[model samples]
Target: MIRKLTKDDQELLMALLRKEPALNLFIIGDVENFGFEQDFMDLWGEIDPADGRIKAVLLRFYRSYLPYADGPFDVEGFAEIIRKDNDIHMISGASEVVKAFDGEINFKQVKQLFFAELKEMNNKISESFSSAEPIKKATVQDVEAICALTDTIEEFESSRNGSRTSLRKTLESNTGRTYYIEREDKVIVTASTSAENSMSAMIVGVATHQAFREQSLASRVMAQLCADLLHEGKSLCLFYDNPHAGVIYKRLGFQDIGSWTIVNM
Candidate 1:
């Protein structure tokens, strides 16, 4: 049976999600930040009648729907919830789970990206980046410079999906953080995290200035960011569509765990 979850279900919900914290980073973060009181967010769960335990979880945040299950789940049931919502904008989750909805949901456009997770730093890369330029944690004052740097990178132009206002809000809320390296008063490279909760964080907006692309500046910045998060006992995860970028992340001890799928409705 499936039912809309309430605050009373928090313990059960977290127990299931924390099983794979990296896979449920966004869901967990949203629950932690918004809880069950937000008008724009709601959660549903599929429970096994036999065990009275949750078998799958689904979250609707604003216009997006995110579903997760460690094994098999009622894809049709979850899809129906999304289908009934006239404001549905996107459906995203593990590629395997999302694929199960192919026949149930009429997808407008689908995008897939390699997903990787890091639990520990690569000792070799850690040692090398140790001598690199000191990285600084970004404040609200750095939002304009950070966005400006990403705007100049051709690779980031089409994929830059965030806004300056949102970036500043995130920094102010303490839900996310950004680390950057600056040269001559200009931001050259940056790495940032989003959907940060107690168990894990999602890496986003890792970019370097066009003139500094091949100089390992991005790697150094990422190393520092990842190290700091891991030190705090949070696992790190990221999605990348570029093979070259995947290679760099792998060198930092990230392993391909699975793929993430985003479907526009």
Candidate 2:
């Protein structure tokens, strides 16, 4: 039976996460904040009448994103839940689920699958190049600056659609981090990371001012961000649909784990 996940399900979900470490952290964190609602279901395979073992589970996010993993569950029952909920954009992992819904509804294999990649950092302090400018962690005072930087990046990359509201949500979360480079007191470059799980994080919203395109500030900020995350003992993960960005990340020691496609329903 598909039903809303309650506080009682937190332990179940966490256990499931341990079984599937690659699950997106945002979704995991979201479930922790707002448990499943009536429109969605946490697909538990089969409930044992006796011990209540949640064989498998998936969090249906606002009927918008459905990710199912860590299961020895009933695929048909899960698909039934999706059909009832509707408007679910995409599901990650398990090709069988994809196949089940392939022709029944509009579906696309457009998610970039990622695995943990490590780059050892040397505590060696390199010369900090002063640009008559400064790099700083974005504060609430820089709301406009932050939004402008994010819009610039999204405009440059058509596939990268980020909302100021969403960015603000992360900024206010306190757990995430956003860094900026300012020149002549004007924000010129920006980068942000979302701490997904205890040990993993994703970098997004990397952008540079138009006039500063060839200046390599983006790379510098990226390098600094990577160093910071590594220092905190978090494994860095990045996603890019653009081949050029992928190439740049490769040069910076990020390896491509797999490809993912996102379908806009």
The residue pairs found clashing in candidate 1 are: none
lDDT (0 to 1) per candidate: 0.91, 0.62
For model 2, give the RMSD to the true fold: 4.2
Tens digit of per-residue lDDT, candidate 1, span 1-265: 8999989999999989999999999989988988998999999999989988888999999999999998988888998888899989999999999999999999999999999999989978867754656789999999999999888878766656666877898899888899999999899999999889999999998988878888888888889899999999999999999999999999999999999999998
- Candidate 2 ranges beyond 4 A from true positions: 1-4, 19-22, 35-55, 70-73, 87-100, 108-133, 154-162, 195-197
| Best candidate, lDDT | 1
lDDT of 1 at 179: 97
lDDT of 2 at 214: 78
Q: How many backbone collisions does model 2 have? A: 6
TM-scores of the candidates are 0.96, 0.75
Best by TM-score: 1
